[model samples]
Target: MDPIRTDVDAPFGRIADLIALNARQSPDRLALADAQDSIGYAALDALMDRVAAGLQRDGVVHGDAIAICAASSVAYAAVFLGALRAGVAVAPLAPGSTPASLARMMRDADARLLFTDAAAAEVIGAPGEDAITRIALDASAAGQALADWLPPPGTRPFPVDVQPASAFNIIYSSGTTGEPKGIVQGHGMRWAHVQRGARYGYGPDTVTLLSTPLYSNTTLVVFFPTLAFGGCVVLMPKFDAAGYLQIAQARGVTHTMLVPVQYQRLMAHPAFDAHDLSRFQYKFSTSAPFNAALKADVLQRWPGGLIEFYGMTEGGGTVILEAHLHPTKLHTVGQPAPGSDIRLIDEEGREVPPGEAGEVVGHSSGMMTGYHRQPAKTREAEWFAPDGKRFIRTGDIGRFDDEGFLTLFDRKKDMIISGGFNIYPSDLETVLRAHPGVADVAVVGAPSVQWGETPEGYVVRRDGHAVDAAELLAWANAQLGKTQRLARLHFIDELPRSAIGKVLKRELRELNPS
Candidate 1:
């Protein structure tokens, strides 16, 4: 039995502590790698030590928050883990966010120490204007370089006694401005995430490839587990289909966590079938709605287990679909994960019976503590059951089949009200995608004088297919009920997407405001 496995099976364990133990047990093992360089367990452990000591020397105390708004890098990982070792909460700001949003997040987290890389620095600007002490992850960025900012060699900070409920990190939600929804995830929540990895095949010999940036909670779910179980990590600063495939093949990568759009691109790549991904053990998808056709194509072509995780960054009510194991249930997002209490609630806040459509609410040991400094907003997101137990509202409308699988509808806010009827945009988008010529699509409610709000679609044409928007709209409406017909269809080169690959429906709405 592996020493790390024994530690991983404990009731609750800190990721930082587990990494420390792995360093002692397997000092020579490769712990992290990027396009430019790699580091062994021993060196990584010492590097973390230097980071923690340097932070302490700079007066960043335990329980205080610090932010990192940068691309993925070996140094970025060390700073994150090292801060955890010191009991400080990390706020990973999305680099793809507008410069104003990033700066606002720093203020929202009350973070004084900020970190950035060369790529992010281009947008985030120079750092000396405020009280923030910026540390540049790479050379030529605004802040102090990590090497020059570190404490002396062989340095170690005073050890911290970490508790499970201590703040682990603050993950902000998607927004351009105003008060950010900083979700404060405790160490307890993260421990449950690591514990759940046993079933997914994460272990010391596992080499997990991460193409997503370090800031996303979507990426961290898999990134943290690999380290806690003594596995190696390979980071990609930017994600491109051909480059991602080359690195996955060269590194003998066993695992990866990609959002749905990345999978779509990979499956469409001509060289996808040519790549030798025989060593792959697990491939994960999350953070966006996955298309059934895309999932089917991957299952038919891709090697290894394909798992789709449906959950929020706020950490409640997780649903897992192991596509390889249950090939028939490709449309449903699987049953509730073990130990997760998933329930459905009506608009009146009453719990609904199974087999009926309702909003998704979930309770689990892995739920977040609360939104940072936003008690009202946090309370708004919770619903107390008759037993007084708390459940996080998923804001998604879904129905459970008699067998317990969940078929998701559009978000409650996104559900269109047309002629006093509820029209799910996902239903309309599904029809448009079936036309074969439509490569990507997004449906939003357009202001309608007659129906109040009607479904409007924005489409991207598949290469070499020239289907007229008006004709496709008519065809889709023919397949739909009278109330669910599309108001208009606009063709574009591509669907606007977030850095994590979620369709930017708001952008689409703004572009075609009625």
Candidate 2:
């Protein structure tokens, strides 16, 4: 497990340069595609040049932030790369965020221009006093159309000086409340990802189907690598189980990145096994917890290597669980990746002994620069070892097994304290998930008059099954320690999730009586 070499003098310093190199070598190859359109390597290279020129003409230069709030599309991809080509940083704001939040993010990034499609524009409405220049990706009343926004076809922007430390993009954290913090990633971090991705079989012949939003780091972790290695990427504006299966089979897709919920939906689809997915060489899952049972099912049924990546968007250490190779370690998140260091500490900031759960913190080369314009928040996220090495606090509670595999228990903030005893929600959630009647479940700390804070369970019943909350609670309590018993249980239609399928525990906590 050698570290990914950082080659400052590589043939292509920037990702845009890599795209240009691919165009020169494989002119006729498909560079990108969506349901409605496709672009060749040569044409995509040319389009990127025009887009860079257009931004330059509008006074966008190095270090400037260009905000894109739209659905995934060929134009959206082009604009993202174009901004990078001009040495500008991109802030991919989520269209699903509220208008006020979006406005705050735009201000935080100091974006002078905004690119959006009709649906996103409708959600955002007018820019008002934000003073952002608007360009529409589709027909909309929001701003100028993309076609009119660009300069002539052959136009090229001036040459840029890109360094390893140059700002690359701003990824906003999915905060449960208030304004989200913008995590600033640099070119060096992205370059490390692109270089290391080759071990997973990304190359010129690779065809990656990305169904996640471009706004998410989960998608870009695979998306940028596919293009950097000269692979074709197929974009899905919105995820549909049937459509995903159809596209994968029809296009002979070779690789893909999907969240756990998407995988659950695909596995439940009636036509799941009906399609031919033998061409898939690798599949990735991240951004949420992947159940061990689901991983085993995928390994047994799906025709590809299933790799689960455990890490934060803030980019400290990463754990890679190759379910195909280490079937016995499926319960753990595997060992830390090469060049990554992970440690656990207790509440008093002391290093916890091995096999004892503690707050997970880590250090790695792929770490983000800092939270944009939030120096105090950035400082709060860091921890230091005796050797003076800096580590990012993951805020997760996990312990290493004798074999060095890491098993996560629960988030530090989600831990329940009942009657002066520490309780891990994941320990309780595991028991609940084993129940036949439970389709999905989330455990959160609820206010309890007797115990201060007690564990509560929110459950989604399996289809065609009737479950009484009291009955289910009694059954679950039978398998748990007395102190860990659920104080209350609530039946819900479904768990509230973020766009990337992360369960929103904050929202569930709100449902509990104070």
Candidate 3:
């Protein structure tokens, strides 16, 4: 039996089809917007057609990759959708990545045309000796500008067929070392996501405020759904707590997907309570461990159904915790989503009994096809069940409660073995976050002579709060088990995070002495 449902005929076969339909049905509705500009559905559709024509004229054909590294804007969205319309896969590279890494990824994707804005072009100076076309989204020294690159108005691209199995986009992982592996997400997978998202209240009247970068899947999950459902999307080039609230209130935003750090910042901002967010019908949090305390605070202060999604970009079984409905289960990541099968496996690859901690693995219709061009790495990411079903290994240590909710401990690689005992850094960080002086905290294993490894903490203090790291460490240790006690504590202004707000634990580990 195929996991994806084939019984019901979907209204649109591809994402581009849905966009085209919306343009014909609601031509004057707002499709995309930013602080500077907004585009209606009709104009967005025409722009995408021209973009497809331009790419076709420039030799970007079916299955070929087109790389875009720029701030989110109307033009960026057009280029992305236009590539899809032309049956080409998009490789949205992170602008925050180093120039060397960016260049390496472009080579790996074999991207024929590279698009960038002025700010990103400045950072990504020049393309390597490899011959590739560079098209700047804005005026810059980076090859030709958008106006010069696009084909003449009314030029139409040749029709190309798009299958469900066709590659839709390549999302690179946030690996700190070496080149990041590209996860190949197919059109069917994206369609599954869009269909599933409609249940969460996305529709023609829905307005989604995207504060994260377009390159991040966390943003695309909401971004594509809003457009596919004929809703409006407001893009934020850079997230600011004050500015987000103002936009949310002014735009009458009905939906949003934000990481935990963004929520924390919004909650901490002085003006957060001043704005009216009652228009929000649904709010999403993912890509990090959201503290239960913070979830409770948001539920109390913010008006919306708070949902937390726990899964990886590589696609596996997803766990959805509706924090608004299940207030008591806020500690867990909620139950497995409908039709999603989740199980825990021991280090030896044997399935663990319920209520026991093990590596989290899952199977679902929405899983990615595989890591791009890396068969060995792709095989390493899979775990086969006895019945011959394949599951994606999440690399997270978690246990299911009697109620079937999953409680995550830490990353499998991040777990510390101290004196032959497993020490989960998340357990220690949870205790540290409870401290009044501790605004944020991250725990990582530090090499030790006494034991193979021990826990060390990096903490950020609350505003206007003065407390010694030694005193806070002592207080936290008093509440923790002997093996979980921190060996050292350091105070920093803020914890380093990725573009989507996941803590960079590898960077913290590098600070520890070997």
Candidate 4:
């Protein structure tokens, strides 16, 4: 059976048609804004046609795989949409990822061509095991070059039919466990997810201030919905607390999304209190579970503005919590999105009842086709149910309430089986953060000879707040279960976080020797 088409056509309606619609309807309206400058819908549409022309000229044919490795810019979007129009599969690599990682992704995704900006061209130009054709993506020159190739306002659109099930883009895994797996986002799945998200709240009138990197699935899902709804996007090439607030005020941005740490930083910023941020309508956060304390802090400051969604890139949005519902269900990730279903199942694949912890499995049209080339993993995630429906087994573990609100319990892999007892690190970290001197904490399962594997607490104290390791350990042990207690303590000045401020526990695990 075919998947549902949420939008006018399929969400994967030809990129050419979508761009042309925006150009015709909102020609003069601003579509993209960044540190450099803003570009309107008409200008962007014309530029995309040009990019498409250039790709065609370069021998890029339909179904060609292209790598987009660069920072956030208007040209980046033009190239991405242009590639889609040209029927090329896009694989966007993170800017900060090592060349080794980049090579792995390119090879894994079987990308034959790379489209990169000048800044990171040197890094992305390095040859891998498999040779790839490199093309320079000059943001400044793209519009002109495209115009040269096709002539802006005169470039002929490609005569191609891109089906919804056709390969649209490849979103790589976070690589938290093993090498990053490329998630296959079909033209239809991408469109369905974007439409579902936009219909929920993200719309044309909304001004989305993006602080996350362009490579992230969050950015991919958010950007299209904002554009489809005729909303303006203010791009933060890289996240900066002070800069974000300034941009929010200067641009009169109505909506934005950030990880939990970014939210904390915004609240911590001294200027946060000085600014009149009443215009801010909705703020969404994910990538990590949020704490009730942090939610309270944001609510006390911004009132009804916080929104949360629970889902990863492979699947689009699963659950959505609005600002109004947030107060009633503080820790819940909210209810399932429309046309989506969630189930909690045990390791043996048995359905677990409400209040019982199990793996969170989701089913929706927005879910990716599969992990690129990893047939084994794909088969496991996208399996058939007894009801003849398809479902993806999210590695995450969570439980539901009687009211149907979901609360994240822990990751299936991250669960510490200490002395036959299952312990969730998040539970320990939350308790540790309650202490006055403790600023932030992460709990990991360290190998233990006696109990097989035991939980270890790593804490970063507030500046100028000195607490002895013994005292901190004692306090943590008092609050935790006998099996969940920290085997040891590692006091660090600061935790190494990702571009989005997610604590890199893998780094900590590598840094701290067993």
TM-score result, candidate 2: 0.97
- TM-score for model 3? 0.97
What is the C-alpha RMSD, rounded to one decimal, of candidate 1? 1.3
Cα lDDT tens digits, model 2, 205-243, are: 899999999999999999999998888999998999999
With candidate 4 superimposed using the best TM-score fit, by how many Å does residue 298's alpha carbon deviate from the native?
Answer: 1.4
On residues 342-423, what C-alpha lDDT tens digit does candidate 3 reach at each position?
A: 9999999999986789999999878888998999999999999999999999999999998989999999998999999999
lDDT of 4 by residue, 1-514 (tens): 2121234445346545665676787799888888877898888877777767667777777777788887887767777887787787889888677778888898887786676666666665555465676655564321223223444465755766788778889988777776788998888877775666544465556788998977887777677777776678888888888898888888888878788888877898888988767777777787777788888789888734687878877883388776455587887888998878888788787787668988888888777878898989888776455787777887888888888888887778778899889898899998888988888888888888889888888888876789888998899899787877888888887887766566777777777657
Cα lDDT of model 2 overall? Answer: 0.89
- lDDT by candidate, in order shown: 0.89, 0.89, 0.89, 0.76
Task: Give the runs in model 3 whose Cα sits over 4 Å from its true position.
Answer: 1-12, 176-178
Candidate 1 segments whose C-alpha is farther than 4 A from its true place? 176-179
Which candidate number would show the highest TM-score if scored against the true structure?
1
Find the 10 residues in a row with the least total lDDT in model 3.
Answer: 1-10
Better of 2 and 4 by TM-score: 2
